[model samples]
Target: MGMLKLEARHLLAAAGAAVMISAPASAATLEVHIGSFKNGGTIPSKYAFCVPAAEGHTTGGANINPRISWSKGPRGTKSYAIIVYDNKAPAEHREMMNKEGVTMTADIKRHNFYHWVLVDIPPNVTSIKEGADSNARVVHGKPATPSAAGVKGLNDYTKVMAANDATKGQYYGYDGPCPPWNDDVVHAYHFAVYALSASSLDLPKDFDGPAAEDAMKGKILAQGETVGLYTQNPTKGAKASK
Candidate 1:
């Protein structure tokens, strides 16, 4: 009887090992790449919403969206999403922002400023060409619309320029970084890609970053990101890319 019990236990253990060996592996993290700059490297002025100006603190840049590509999502991934935002935006303090004497320190209060929010990208679409979303600055901002690549959603620039007559409008799609010129801290722009289980979030018209995030919820399968640094401050060693 003791020998029979020991053999039963051995059989159970063997079965457990077989089950473990046959089990599928977890999904791998997607590999994201930025064509214009290295990950965690400085971003060029050509891809910025603002750049160093000869006379003023800053001026409108090329505003081109850098080329981006990503690895295919794992099995069960139906679509993908791209979100680009600045993680080091200065806090709301009008008096000190852009002031020549004021130095926005690294420890200053910061917030996320969304520059691009595109969703519902097809699984087969693995890359976006340079300037495909935005080639130059639009005076009143581009129209919020959907295209072959994905749905272009409202960026933070809409709120940032709401009070300005010349630039005020519903800014959409890829509007690149424009860190405060007086800021002493270098800003990090995160270009993230999300692999989703669903084909579409079905976001509402004129949807923003928060709205997209709400829609993504539990549908995200895998995600990856690459960071690019930028600062309009001349002392930070960034030259205007003309």
Candidate 2:
């Protein structure tokens, strides 16, 4: 009877150890939404960088920032950061693109380009209204003043338009999609919202997407993302038929 009792105690201890080993760390949850378009859906032309227009003149889209919102962040989340990037841009010879007008092909390896970077979003703020940062063409350097919600960061458009005589300026805020018109592949724009533990990033005025991301490292409590598709080229069959 004594031996049986000892064995039962050992078995219970082993079971408890197993349970402890299998337990998972607490996870944070976040839900992201964009009212202008659905996840994995086609983005409207009005949100594109350049859209087909009359008189053979390519015109900029409505150039409005899409409405974005998120649910409550994790328990420790005190602020949020928004990043919009395109992972399908050609990686080769990006520096010479402006001077050479280099066209990116579908076969090349793609790289990321940051289109929008807004940071220090207050915990109480849950949404950004549409057209809040609208401009027909590119706008150079928005004031770095932090609003009640947050401040805007420099986007990749600043780099792209820096060499252009007419568009050259320190482009900031949201610049919509403007993928190559001849590429065979359609590009996807990823919009991510990160719940951060820090109340403010305290980033410098020159901070870009990468800068903001680096500052938020190890401070992120949760993250959620949505993708929107865009293309400057028409479908192959549709173009051929036309």
Candidate 3:
């Protein structure tokens, strides 16, 4: 009877130890940061495609890409991808856009407008300094090319600039916010980073945000983002919301 009781105590202890060993640890969160702009704060005009102009509604801006950084991913993270896009692009009443006598109200529906799409960033790389990718705006847009840092994907400016002959080109990499100057609402830009399981998604050189997102669908191990607000409208100042 004494031997059986000792055996039962040992079994219970072993079972408790097994449970503790098998339990998972708290998951680490991926954190993103932008050096030039605060999350949920105004994005400076220096990083915009257009800024408030004295003569009229707007004018060309410095258009510099802001500095971005992120925390290392959890174990098995092979690479990273960065995507920047405006989340409040007017989706309707396009005819009223930038018209002298009309206004694009805040009630108008909005859509996502890709400003930058870079992928296949090395696992060791965790930060991109300001102006490292783009120091100034290119007239016909920069070439969609691959470099040691990562691959630059085509931004939505490709379609937006299609109507103009001089600016009509494959607008690649970063082209900062240029929301309609006549708009009544402020726009939000999301700077997101994704830790990918695959080193390369083998994406084509002409890929866009949607394509990059599709490629990263199953391979994304973790993700994080920060939002910055911007507006070309003079009425809605830098800190204006809605």
Top-scoring candidate (TM-score):
1
lDDT of 2 at 182: 54
TM per prediction:
0.86, 0.79, 0.85
> Candidate 3, clashing residue pairs?
none
Candidate 3 C-alpha lDDT tens digits along 1-242: 12223233333333223111111234345799999866666777789887777666777888899999999998998999998987678788877888898889868887778998999999999998898787788898988655447889999999889999988999889999998888876676788888888999899778998899888877777777777777777666532222
lDDT of each: 0.78, 0.68, 0.78
Decreasing TM-score order of the candidates: 1, 3, 2
TM-score of 3: 0.85
TM-score of 2: 0.79
**Candidate 2, 1-242: lDDT as tens digits:** 12223233333333223111111135365688999776766667767676643333245666778888998887888999888888777677455332324455567776788888899898988888887765455555445545436888888878877877777666567778876655555666778888888999999888898888889877878777777766655431112111
Q: Number of clashes in every candidate structure?
A: 0, 0, 0
Candidate 2 — what's its lDDT?
A: 0.68
Worst 10 residues of 1 by lDDT: 15-24
Candidate RMSDs in order: 15.0, 15.0, 16.0
* Candidate achieving higher TM-score, 2 or 3: 3
Reference-based lDDT, residue 31, model 1: 91
Clash count in backbone of candidate 1: 0
> Which residue pairs in candidate 2 have backbone atoms (N, alpha carbon, C) closer than 3 angstroms, thus clashing?
none
lDDT of 1 by residue, 51-116 (tens): 877567788898999999999998898999998877668766756888878887867777778899
